[model samples]
Structure formats: C-alpha cells, structure tokens
Target: MKMNPITLIIVLVFLYPILKGFLFKFSSRDLKCDIDDLSRNISFIIAIISGTYFGKKIFIQHDDGIYRNIYNHIPQQILDYLENNNLIIYAIVIPIIVFIIYRVIKLILDLLNYVTTYPALDSIEKFLSSKGNIFKRTTGMIFQIPKGLCYVLLVAFALNIMSVLNVSSKLNGYLEGSKPYKSICKSIIMPVTNSNIAKKLPNILNNSFRIVIREADSGRQIEPNSDTPATLNQTNGRKTVVYYNGVTLDQGVKSDPQIDKLAVALGSEGTNTTEKAQMLYNWIGTNISYDHDKANKVLNNDFNVRSGAISAFETRKGICFDYSCLYVAMARTNNIKVRLVTGEGFNGISWVSHAWNQVYIPESGKWINVDTTFYKGGNYFDNPRFSIDHKDAQIAGQW
Candidate 1:
C-alpha cells in the first residue's frame, strides 16, 4: 500500500503527547504541576471552542443591529474601506480578539482554581503519584488522551473554518488529502456547524457589510415602446415589459441628460431597431475601456450598479456589469428594449461572474444576447456558441 504522508504526520502529532505522558517518569511535585497545567490547557480549549461557536451565533442573531450601529456612525469612505477589506480584517482581528478574550477568561479561571481547588487537586495528584510508577504513568496517559483529542479538535475546527471560507486553495487541498482531518471534519465539525443559522452566516456577513439603501420609487410610470407592439413574437408573445410585484423591469435603469443625448445621437444612424442596437453595441465595445481597478473593487464586494453605470457613461471605463448597465440605460433612451443579464462568463481561464445584455429586435421578433465586455476579443453579439461559455444566465432587470 502507498503510504499517505499527511495521514502519517497527523498520527504522529496526535500520539506524541500521549506517549510522552505514559513513558516520562515524574516526581509527585512535578506530576501535580503537570496536572495544574493540564487543567489550564483544558480551560483554554473550552474557551476557544465556545467562543467561536457562540460568537458566530450571536453575530448571526444581531447582525442587523450591528450593521445599523456601524452604518450610522462610520463615514462612507471608511465604511467602504472596511467592507472592501472585511475578509482580511475578520481573518486577523477576530482571532486576535478571541485569543485576548480567552486569555482574560483563563486568567480568571486560574485565579479561582488557585484559591478554591488547588488544595484538593494537590491531594488527588499526590495520591495518584503515590500509587507507584506504573499506576502514575497509566493515570497520566489516560488524562492526556482527552487533552490530545481537544488539541486535535481545535486544530481541525480552525482548518474547517478556513476551508469553508476558501481562504487558500493549496492549504485546503493538502488538508483534504489528510485522512484524519477529513474524518474529524465529517464526524465532529460538520455536525456542530451545519445548522441552518451557521449555514446562513456567510451571506449574513456579506449583506451586513455591504449595505445598500434604496429609496422609495417615485410614482412615475414606464412608457411602453411605441415602435414595437405591446407583445413580441419572442417569449411566446409575452408583454414587452416584465414585472415582479409592483416593480417594472426598467425600474433600476438610471439615466441622465448626457446619456439621453448620446443615445439619441448613436441610435439616429440606424434605420431599424436591430441596426440601432448593433450600432450602440459596437460603439460601447469600441469606446469603453474595461476598468480593472473597478473590477477588483467589485470582486471585493465594494460595488454599486447605479454608480457603476454612471461612472462608465461619464468615464467610458467599466467591468461587465457596468457595460450591461450602460447598455440598458442607453438602449432604453432610444426606446430599444433591453435587459441586463448576469451570470458566469468564461474568461479563457475560468468561468467568472459576468454581466451582459439581451436586446429585443422587433425586425427579427427575437431577443439576442450581446456582450460588449468581450468586444476587445471578438464578436460576442448573438454568438451561436454563447451558451458554451456563458451559463446560468438570468435576467437582472430590463429597460
């Protein structure tokens, strides 16, 4: 059989302390001190486990309150900075805070133990030591097993959390190959952290940090496109405007005087909706540069669609979402029906979260895909193999 190095390492690490406890002879005084040290170690272990478990639950329960407090007090720029770097902050600050809390708690417990339990424990330790070398060794080993297991459990729990957050792919891969890690995770960690509240924690944290406050909409109604019929031949002759609850598809589309004027000028060159849509697509792809900085900020969860579209229009730089948002606003200004679609797009290396547009052309009586973000690469406008790379495509909003 092939020897699994990771499993061997885990076994050795787990057994080392237990074996040491069993084999190493100690005087009564030393054994008593060791017992005190074991108690302290156990207290520290319990503090960490309980702190992590309960801290998560408390955060989940009161996330909204916490968010509101922070949102109200912090400046917007500082909030943005914090939200952008929340993962790093949590990774570093949370552990340090937990450790500090654990140390304080351990100090209190130690002081209490010294005052109340030291005499009794000393008597017990002396009695065990007096039972002869073999008995003393066996007792120490038996006591050491639970402490060793606690150490393993704590390490495994930390690894499980890092794995859940996908902190490092290389580290996670190594851990996955370790049989002991996998076994403990499956048997112990999963059971404790797989509850509904625990499962919702990531999303809760994300939402709490990235707070978006949308104002109530004005009562202005969306005017139906006069060029096309109320229903199109596509979508089985469904109405041109899609609605959810009382909200229309174009509700999120933002516009300004500059955008409106530019759209009119762009669309004026084409005779029909298809021609106009293509012209607009070509212009956006050729003119607008992809903003890599904004893309990185967005990946860190510091992005706003309204702001993105506005910035893209004014600056001619944006990522996929910005491209799609700009397209929707411009198309709507020209009375060209368009929808912002968001999903994964293959960027050669991997599938990434991407946004594009689908324009309804009355001439073809069909809605076609358009990805202006890929203009630098090639024609993505209604590409037949579009589905080959773009997947899980869902309409975000229409205009």
Candidate 2:
C-alpha cells in the first residue's frame, strides 16, 4: 500500500509542489518544457479534493468498521495478519489513480498542440531538426513516456489482483471489541495529592494544547520539544509505575487519575485534558533528570524496561526513551490517547534513534506528537503541531 493511489494523496497534497523547484539542479542544459502546466494543475486539484473527501470515507471510517466486524468473527492472529494486508491497500490506490489521470491529461494536451500546429516541414526545418547528439539525448527521455505508463498500469493491475486474494479477513472469533487502548491505564499512585496540583492539571493541559497549535502553523520540520536523553528514571518490573510516576488518585499502579478528583477539579465529567497535559510536561521538565546508564540495557530483554520516557520518570532521569514513555503513561492516566513513537533524532553531532509520543486530538481527529525530553530541557516549543511517523500508534492495553 505504500505506493497506493489514494494513500499518496497525503504526500501529493503536502510535498509534490516543492519538487519542481529542484528540477533545474538535474542538468545545466537548457530544455524546452513539454508539460501542459494548466492541465497538470487542474488534475492535481481534482485529485486532492477527491482523494481527501472520498479517501477519508474509506481509510478513516470504513476500514474501522471492517476491523470491528473482523474482530468479532476472527482470531487475534488472523486479525493481525489481515491488518498487515490491509496496510497494503492504504499504501497503493490513490497514488496510481492520481498519476494515471495527471499523465493521461498531460499527454493528451501535448499531443493536441502537436496535431494542431503541425510544424511546417521544409528543407530549412529539416536542417534545423538535424538534431545534435545532445538534443537526441534530451528528447529520448520524453519519448519514454508511453513506456512509463505501461509499467505503471502493469503494477496497478498486479496489485489489484494480489489485494483481493491476499487481504482476507477470517471468522475465527478469536478477537473482541475494540477499546480506545491509549486511554486505558494500569497503575495508581498518589503524587502527594496536592489539591493545588489537581486544580492546576487542567489549566496546564489547556496551555499545552497550544504546543500542538504552534506545531501546525510552523513548518512540519519544526517539531515540539523532543529529547535525545531523558532526565526521568527507569522502571522496575512494573509497567504502570513509569506511566503514572506522579501521584495516583486511584489504587491502580497505572497513571490513571481518579475520575472523581478530575471531575471535581473540572466540575464536569471530562477533565481539561490540555491543561493536565501541559502541567505534566512542565512538572517532568522541572522535577526530573536524565539517567543514561540505565539505558545501556537492551529493550528486548525487558518489555517493561523503563530506560526511555517511562523509566526516566521512575528514576528521575532517563534518555529520550524515559521522557517519552512516561509522558505516554501519565497522559493516558488523564484519558489521553498517547502513542509512543520510535525513530531517530538529528542533533548536529550524531544521529541517534529515539522514542517520542503522539496524542490523539479528537477536535482535529488526528494524532499530534509531544516530546517531553525537549520540554524538560527548556526547548519550550509551545503549541506543537503533530504528525505521525506512521499511523496507529500502539499501546500496552494498560495505557
């Protein structure tokens, strides 16, 4: 699905235009442009609008419905298998369609002009056409356009056949109803239970919501506060302990806060998620320190390893892993959908793979990244905009 027609809409809408500027860098030779710019733009516009409105109908909602039905009818292993196949669908469709439509129109327009103009043929014209070796080389690439289309269609046809047969769901009844996994929590600890802290959490989360907003307005490259190393602690065998490093209003070791306390603070059934998140971000940055020594242990050895964000908060110091994991854990305690993201960071000195978090914002119907380690270090990228390295951030059922 990585090369799918519909899935490519995201890339097309966001990044394609920038590539044209780089074309001149490919060669110093002067070349006449053959593209029908108007039709190309029109095709791009149509593709974007159609892909957005129609693509969402399938990718955003219908797929979820299919998954729900499959979960009821299939086994977990089968469901997992189908999910992988389903990804293939998302990665393929829109891109092929967009390319086909755009190219077909461009080809038609270019041919129409050639037919209408019918450049006069004469001895002088022939002499001018005695193409130099350089002109032949340049023209050769353009002649390959039809060949390109055949290859594209071949790929699309083969994928379509593979999809129907391979994207199969089962009816084994091995799975169950889907819960918002990111919001579930397992630990319950009290962080000295400051009435003031309870009161302040909502306000803090609200402020932190601004971090997401800023991220949106700024270019995608300018990320919110992220971390290379964490100042929080590592975890013991417990998973809930790291996520809920602070006080727990509930008896659970997970970071889930007491609904009653939250309700009392907010004066409503829902807590001020934005404010609480902000406060947690602020608290972790100011209260903790990063401990890199614990990170020396490999993650596979301990699924519950607190070396990252989770562990850092527990030990009061960690590398990026601790800060991010703890944020994911604690944020979930407040009923926030925090996803742990594993990737690398660019810090000018060296490149290191790192972990961060993404929280789903219902208001935007999207997941936004939140990096606690950077905030802890005072980078303070407020109201950060969010995008995923990939879709569907996973969770440990325990939030």
Candidate 3:
C-alpha cells in the first residue's frame, strides 16, 4: 500500500505518548511524571505534526502547480514570498522560535518577581496576577514545545531524505503488474511492421493500465473526458520550421546549468546528429522509466507538465511529455534540431495519447522519429515508418 503522509502523521502522534511514557519510567529523575505534563507533551507534539503536515502539503501543492486553486484567495506578493522561501524549514523552525519567545517572556517575568518591591514591578506583577495564571501556564508549556518540535524536525528531515532517495519508486516496482489484466487488447494498425513491436504486443495487452489512454498523448484519438494537452502549437509545417518551432516552444527545458552542461558532455563526443541523438536516447531510455504513480495521477487529472525536463531528469521518472521534454532539452542544448511531438502512439498494447520526438538529421535531410520513452536499443528510433505507431502527431506549442 502507498504510505499515506496523513497516516504517518497520525501514527507519529499516537506513538509519541508511548515513547514518552517509556522514557519517563527509565529516566524518572531527568523528567517530570505528572499527568498534566504528559497531556501538554501530547498536545505539543500533535500541534507540531499538524503544522508540519499542512506546511508540507502547501509546499507540495505549489510544486504540483495547484497553487492556482488558492491564488485568488491569497495576495500575489504573499504567494510569491512563500514560493521563494522554503516552507518546510519555516514549519520546523517557527515552533522553536515561539518557544524562544516564551522563554524571553518568562525571563522578564522572573526579573519582575525579583524586584516586586519596586512600584513599577509591583504594578506589573499585580496586572499579571489578575490574569489568573494564563501567562504562567502559557510560558510553562514552552519547555516541552522545543522538545516536541525537535522530534518533528527529525521525522521531517528523515522523510525528506527518504523521498529524495525515491523509496516510493522501489515500493512501486514491487507492486507493478500485481493487479490482473483489466484493459481489453484492441488490434491497432501497426504503422510499421517491425518484429520488435510485434514481440512486445502480448505484454501490452496483458498489462492493465490504471488510467489507460488518458495518461499519455494519442496522435489523433478524440479526448472525450480529459484535461487539455499541456502544450499547444500555432503553425504546422514539414521543413525545418516545424523543428525550429518545436525548439521555440521549449523555454525552460534546460534551464538548469548542471543539466545543460550534462547534455553538452554527453553529446560532445558525437561527430554527427545521428550519433548525438543516439547517445541522448540511450541515456534517457537507460536512465528513466515510465512512472506508474504519475500515470495514475494523470488519469485522475492531478499531473502538470510545467517543469518538464528539469523535473524529469532530477526525478528520473515521468510520463511521455516528461521523457520527450528531456530529450528535446538535451538535443536542443547540443544544437541538434528536435521537435516535441504530441499525439497517439501505441504502447505495445493500446494506442494512447502520447508524446515523442522527431530529430532532424542534417546529413539525410530528414526528420527521424524517436520515442525515448520507449527506448530499447534504438528499436523506436529512426524507423522509416515511425508514423505507423505515432499517429495524430503534431508539434507542442500553439497557444
């Protein structure tokens, strides 16, 4: 089962009290053993967890491109500030800062108590006393707040590291294909009669897709109930314009200097367009994989294509758009003409809306179709009749 972050938060909340009780038993001298103190500990931990959860969720929300949902509600400047700052750090540090403020207040109260004979100090003490120990209880809870916050920080840090390592990807690999075949295998018109495509047909038919055609681009299949394509194109052409326009559509594909440099290093050895394209195709196909979780999210209308290559290269998992975008990014960075194509393509089983690419070979004066997402030893690269599988294909930016 997927590890629900919400469930983890709840587990942590419940687990804290037991751990605290165990520690209290063993370290009675170091810790207090009052029921009220235990209650305060539990409350503080719960608060920290709640704060962390919502904070992380908001951070993810912005990353996932769903901030538009709250864009109107929040001022743009505040949203911009949140986007610029790391919410996760703030989430962990804010409570500790509050604890520090409490400590400062308590120190001032202590100084006032010591000088109670002074008229000003006496007046302040009387004012505080009239408030009926509210300040006392509030400041008293400060000591435990930092402890609870420290625990929260440790858990958050560990979780962040685990996410970076993509523990979820390992877990997903085990669960893939566990479910029975669910999609009916439809006979697709094989545009190219390649034996390799034939060999993979059975696997596609038996493999049940959770989101099916909705997840990937189809060359020309009518999308009846799906979100609009992430990219658009204004003009269509058959020559270098088509390829150049595709390059134009790619704005931030290789925005990262690191990835830009990696692209250069990978393709620098290639003496020609074909060799460079092959190197990039091999790198992507060998490195990346079809993200099932992301596909499921796309099926549920929860995926975005704004980050493109940077996200795909960093995460090493994405759907067709991601794969195509990275290839386009790398290829263009090396000064090779490439176009990001969107349409329906067969995935060994069914024809789905997909994204692939066409790289212009200067020597041959032709645009060779390349499906880096389905890269298998150049099987899907430069096939003379690639249009057979990649139908309804067009360049990505129109709108």
* Residue ranges of candidate 3 with Cα displaced over 4 Å: 1-254, 304-307, 397-399
Error of 1 at 315 (Å): 48
For 294-380, candidate 2 gives per-residue lDDT tens digits of: 333332222233333334444676655556656665666567766655544322111234455666767667755566655532233
What lDDT tens digits, residue by residue, belong to model 3 across residues 236-255? 22112112112233553554
TM-score each candidate: 0.44, 0.30, 0.41
Candidate 1 residues 133-188, lDDT tens each? Answer: 88877766775676577667666766665654555646645665577876775555
lDDT of each: 0.61, 0.38, 0.52
Looking at candidate 1, the ten consecutive residues that score lowest on lDDT are: 202-211
Best by lDDT: 1
* Per-candidate alpha-carbon RMSD to the true structure: 19.1, 18.5, 21.2
Candidate 2 residue 277 C-alpha distance from true site, Å: 1.9
Worst 10 residues of 2 by lDDT: 181-190
Estimate the lDDT of model 1: 0.61
